[model samples]
Structures are given as C-alpha cells and as structure tokens.
Target: MNEQQRTILAIASRVMSYPSESSAEEREHIDEAVDENIESADIRKHLRAALAPLDALSTRDIQEIYVSTFDLKSKTGMYLTAHEFGDSPKRGAAMIKLQKIINEAGFERTEGELTDYIPMLFEFMAVSPEDAHHERLQRRLANVGQRMLNHLEEENPYYPFFTLVMTKVFPNPTDEEVARLERDREEADLEELPYPIMYQ
Candidate 1:
C-alpha cells in the first residue's frame, strides 16, 4: 500500500485499541494523518465521529466501556479468529500461524494479546512490507474482520471503528460475502456455551 494508506491503517490501529486515556500524542497523530489524506475525507469524518465521545469520557469510564463492550460481551470481541473458530483446535492452529506471520514481519506481539486481535492485524498491515505474504495475511484478516463486524451491534461505540477497519482491509466485500459472514456469526452465537461453562 501507499504512504497514505499506511498512515490511515496505523491511525486506525491505535484508535481501535483499548486506551486508558485519549493522549494528546494520539490525537496529534490522528490529526496529522487526517490532514495528510484529504482523499480519505469520509473515513476521517467517520473516525472523528467515533472517537469524539470516547475522547470526552474519563479514563475510568473509557476503561469500563472497553471491558464491558469487549470483555463482557462475546459478540463484540476483538479477537477475530475467535468469532469463526471459537475455542476449538482450529483457532489455536490459526493463532500459531498468525503469530509466525507477525514475527516474520518483525512486529512484536503484545503479552497476553493474541496475534489475531483486530488491532494487531492493523499493526501488521501498517508495518509489513507489501508482498505476497502481506497480501495473503490481509485477505485472511479481511474475512475474519467482516465476521467480527457482523457480530457487532450497530449502536455500539466501537462499531464504527471496526467498520472503518473492515472497509480499509476488505474495500469491497460483496453482498453475498456479507450474508455469509452474518450467517456464520449467527451460527457461532448459537454454538457458544454459557459463560459459566465456557472454559470447561
């Protein structure tokens, strides 16, 4: 991808991550990105709208929202592979492969965070040089990203953030493709075990 696309992806990665507070440095980075990419006006507007309310909230409130929205809720999970593979061996294998790819790209995985975390995918996109490996990784991520978007409630504050990432990664997901993703999300929801028995 070009410099503008790289910048946009990096900004989105930071915006979608669980932040304790809206630091001035983060805001400045986003502002500089927006200023540089006039062609991406709609994306910039959507990102600003999504982040405005988040920026106004206190650190504690933001943390609560993050926990409740992502931690407490299964449908809005940030782990992309979990939506498709659940806790099965498939998900574990996928995670291993993804970690390998991320390592090969020279991006360090955050402790306690899976390689398939949505923000990490964006980070990979931002740092990895454009090549066949990047293309394959992006394609896989785009598929999982759409599935995550399907699971997210439209009214959720983080919905726009995921939507922005999906649009950037997928660009042109077909209607049929979205229908399949929605169906997969529904099936996954049905198969999900109750909270108490989930780990057993």
Candidate 2:
C-alpha cells in the first residue's frame, strides 16, 4: 500500500486499540490518581512513522480523511450532533479542555482540511443509506482510480502507458495505430519518462 494508506491504517489501528472509556470499582476513586497522559504523543509517533513517506501529502491529507469519513448516515442524530458540536460554543469549551490535555502530553491538535471532510461525508451516507453507500463509494473509487491512471499517462513522456494497457485489452481496435504500436512495445519502453507530479 501507499504511504498515505499505511498512515490511515495505523491511525485506524490505534483508535481501535484505545479504550473509549473505563470504569472503576467503588470507593475512593478521586484524589490525584493517574497522571496526565501522553497518549496522543505516543500515538503520533506511530502516525508519523506510517505517514513519513507521504510528506508531500501533509496539507491535503486531513481534508481527504474528513470527506471520506463523515457522510451523514443516521437519523438517530448522534453523528450529526457530534459533527455540529465542533461548530458550537459548547464544543469550543470542550475543545479547549481537550487541547489542554493533549498539549500536556506534548502533542498538537490539528484541524482537518477540506479533503478530510469527504470521509465524514462517506460516513454520513453509510449511516443513512446503508445499502446504497457501498455502491456509491465503489463508483467514486473507480472514477478516482481511472483519473490516477490518466494522470500517470499525462505526466509520463515515455509514451502513454495507460493507452498501451488499454489498447492491448482491445486488440481489434478501430485504430490500427494502436496495433502497430503494440508490435513496437520495446521501442515505446525505451523512450524517456518524465518525473511524477510533486504534491507540494
């Protein structure tokens, strides 16, 4: 998998591993028990390791996560309520408290950008239209995949690799030009390719 994919997996794994809440036995649970935690900083170490190869993706990464995850899916109001809280005064207060805790742990809080919001959109849809969500997301992925393939072709000067793959799958194409090139695959492979796009 790509670096971003690995980072996403690492974060997902960390969240899955962390306990959301814990309860204690009766009596004397108060008075200065556990020290403030560096959980976020610890987790950030893993996240940074996984995402290091994707340094170019820093600015756009969070936005992609938000978009893919937060789709409005439920009528029960839970997800929407949480999403709304971020924009409300109560949430602001909560965020301050949360940030303090994280800061004490030597970790910084970061707001996701526009692309990150897309994941939230997906999550929203999943909660609402259970069956349709899978299909919709599938189509979206395919479209994006195709675009990536096209991008690879456009950015490369060694002849279009995508076109080569495509026309090969359809040998009886109306364009004999494609057939002719297929015969000269070695020649095409010898051409110089350009550098890939730098995300930054």
Query: What RMSD, rounded to one decimal, does every model reach?
Result: 3.6, 20.9
- Report clash pairs, candidate 1: none
By TM-score, how accurate is candidate 2? Answer: 0.21
After TM-score superposition, the amount by which residue 114's alpha carbon in candidate 2 deviates from its true location, in angstroms, is: 12
Best by TM-score: 1
lDDT of candidate 2? 0.30
Instruction: State the displacement of the C-alpha of residue 107, model 2, in Å, after optimal TM-score superposition.
Output: 0.8
Deviating ranges (above 4 Å) for candidate 2: 1-9, 13-88, 111-200
Q: Write the per-residue lDDT of candidate 1 for residues 151-183, one digit (tens) a residue.
A: 677876667766766675456656775566555
Candidate 2 structure quality by residue, lDDT tens digits, 27-85: 01211111122134443354434333323333344334222222222111112122224
TM-score to native of every candidate shown: 0.77, 0.21
Error of 1 at 123 (Å): 0.9
Candidate 1 has a TM-score of 0.77
